[model samples]
Target: MIFDEFDPKEDKIFRLIDNEGQVLNASLMPDLDDEIIVKAYKEMLFARVADEMAVSYQRQGRMYTYPPNMGQEAIAVAAGLVIRHEDWLVPVFRELGTWLAKGVSLKEIFLYYMGNEAGSNFKNAHHVLPFSIPIASQVQHAVGIGYSIKLKKIDEVAFTFVGDGGTSEGDFSEALNFAGVWQVPVVFTIQNNQYAISVPVRSQTKSINLAIKSYAFGIPGIKVDGNDFFAMFLAYKEALEYARAGNGSVLIEALTYRKGSHTTSDDPTKYRDKGEETEWAKADPIIRLKKYMDHKGIWKEDETALIEQYRTEVDKQFEEAEHFTPYQLEDVFQHTYVDMPDDLRRQKLEYEQFLTWKENRK
Candidate 1:
């Protein structure tokens, strides 16, 4: 019994569980078997550890630029759990957690961040496309994939993750419109993490809720508490079912916050207040979920120790990633196309010769 008493203007913010780990809506609870609960806990733990390790790796110069999803573990893990492995995941850059949940290898992910072409090679087993950095471009790709699935009469759906800023893009609007008109099976998840770089949500749009924007496209829209794993799971589960049943696309605006800087290069202190970060930290998704597990007697001290041990392994993996040979200058030319243009071929040869001369001098 998800809350039906939502105000389009105010109650669009659906919350089944509060930040203190209290269940606000009993109906929103999934049929939590012990096995499922434990699995959720493990996923949450892994996400947190991966996030921390990514930050540390970036600082150690083992990884290229990285974004930290410290507080939004529940949104990614719960959504991932609800979707099938065969489903396509079209993720934006901030959705590393979502990609991980979709069966992307940690080594491959590290390789991508380390500038290796192998990082983007998980195309077959993992239906996840490479992470898109151009904001709303991936939304169109999701819509396209969904359209193709519908044409093939396949029972598959595409999930596209974007931020509040992406909602303002023309691509976002076009994708939603196309999905609605074509009755494509897709889930457009807008993780509204408050600020779009330095722009606040208040200035992003005049609409009261991002979910309501879907109404204009003639699609069902729902807003969920992104930090509550159960709530997000339920919302996504319902939306996915609706799509599979040929009800077309659904828009889910997950109201959440980014608890850290936008990326390793970002400085939140310049644009946002420190108090806001502290506020979100107290309501951290991992902490709240751990509390919930503790109250249910599902979390144990020994299990925590095991998770820490896993973190140590992750650290070791990062060290291994550092030893991978960086891409050679000539390797870039090989992957550019099936047949390199004559000009590019000549340039490649010249660059290789220059590198050889420089190496001989050294």
Candidate 2:
């Protein structure tokens, strides 16, 4: 299935890949080199398996609270591939897919979510920020980084990830305003995963589309099919190049559905309709990508085999992560600040005294 016509637009949603394994725009189709395509496929599979493992760990009480990035695989992998090593990545909490693409080990993420704060260091993760769980806070960080880069005149861009609901945040608006006036090289990629927690997009904004909001800030924006790997890859590449060229910022609205709950603490079934989920399931991005690869003869392995490989890698990583020293009460004191505050120092001392007293009583 091949459809090749035009590129993505601001007012209209851009989708180069379709549900039936069709390439909507053949001319604009990115070079799906076998090596890269296969790598992308395996990465998507790994993201999926790792997401599933995160859920499993949470249920078994081995992991801390985490937001699952299950169905958002394609967008992350595509964006990751296009982003250069020198550029910075400003991320919200739910960007496991992009993290993998940036070459961060799954072990790092597994450790972080498993309650080891050391994982936050991300040893080799150059130019990547710590995960910002607060809504839209990372947008400001990206804008700040964009400004710093411009001051230094570094030929680098910053890609920031946000969500549908995050757009409503005042911080996002401020970031966009500053980015526009400063003309920084930043790309704000919104993962419009339809629903934000229990709130649907329709309930949040009356705007025709999310990307078009960039127009107010004198920047270009496009809404692409988040699930289509081809569209995601090309769109990100285009945006990255545009920003790097000093043409100001770009906002990307990736239209897709969150196939699962917002986080381990959430239950989508309580709010979303089953029918809606089934509809989105039919358009599973990974499945479509796999089909395209199979038809092109680049990916010949059976689905079962591929998944088995994914499970083996993911499971092994999970096992290794378990050996990390467990999080302890003292960590609260240890990690609070580099130079411990006096009040916190007093609190830690009190805690230690209490522990000693309890031990003596025993």
Candidate 3:
């Protein structure tokens, strides 16, 4: 169950539940009660519905550009299920599920995609940081937060989510090295979805696995089945526990697939193979858990229907969220600093003047 104990060629990949939800290895399974399982299931269900709604909203011009985490629910939910609320979560763009799992409200997420400033206003509820879209930029923030936590003698750990493509960035490597050298309590999670835009994983790096890169930094690395909830949960739990126990940092590579377009603006059909999509779809995280639940007699058809009903309610919330006014053009300068400087003031004025002139020309 530990990183060093794992073999890269044989035991690097762990699976407690298969794609069909069959319990493949019960030994590694985490102790979970019915209530927790049901809660996890609900979170996954809501995440799927929310992701779909956001995609739909974007297609209809109700929201701004958004990323889709269609087939990666288990990665978020499992991590969410294990991490403490006091622990800080730094996420990349494709982490809607993690946010929700960390107790972020559905309304707030929808509002964020809808371009409302109020959506990013969950300052007091959770330690969830704002979503970052600039590849591996958030990794540094997570490292800084973890360092601060250590300095303050807080029992807090930082979990940062990045993609396989983000690993190519210099910031990713620097963050891992900094955390490893400083022995900061941080976990760097790389969700290897196989593609960074049109670039495939094969071209991303020649390493057999992303986890193996951790060896250079003197930190433990793990590669797990991202679709298998139990595997992800156990792996994350182990890493988080290690960090909390003052074991420095760990790198986790969750081997998952995108299973859909990169985002609402992307078109996978252009570069990806159709067969690969179908193959990954068969390993759907929700279906895998449902199969296991059914086998254990814990899942019922009627209960699934209720879950769907709840999803419908989530959709309704998105609809209601859309009614709120979008962020004003000037509001963009507000969050960057406490007060606008002379340079920003002049830029804002120029932007306002451009808008005014356009309107007059019309």
For residue 218, model 2's alpha carbon misses the true position, in angstroms, by 1.2
Residue by residue across 196-292, what tens digits does model 3's lDDT show?
Answer: 9889989999888898888888888888888888888888899989999998999888989887789878999999988888998888988888888
lDDT of each: 0.83, 0.85, 0.85
Model 1 score (lDDT):
0.83
Count residue pairs with overlapping backbones in model 2: 6
- Residue 62's lDDT within candidate 2 is 82
Residue-pair clashes per candidate: 0, 6, 0
Evaluated at residue 68, the lDDT of candidate 1 is 86
Error of 3 at 215 (Å): 0.3
What are the runs in model 3 whose C-alpha is more than 4 Å off?
Answer: 9-11, 301-304, 357-362
lDDT of 3 at 146: 92
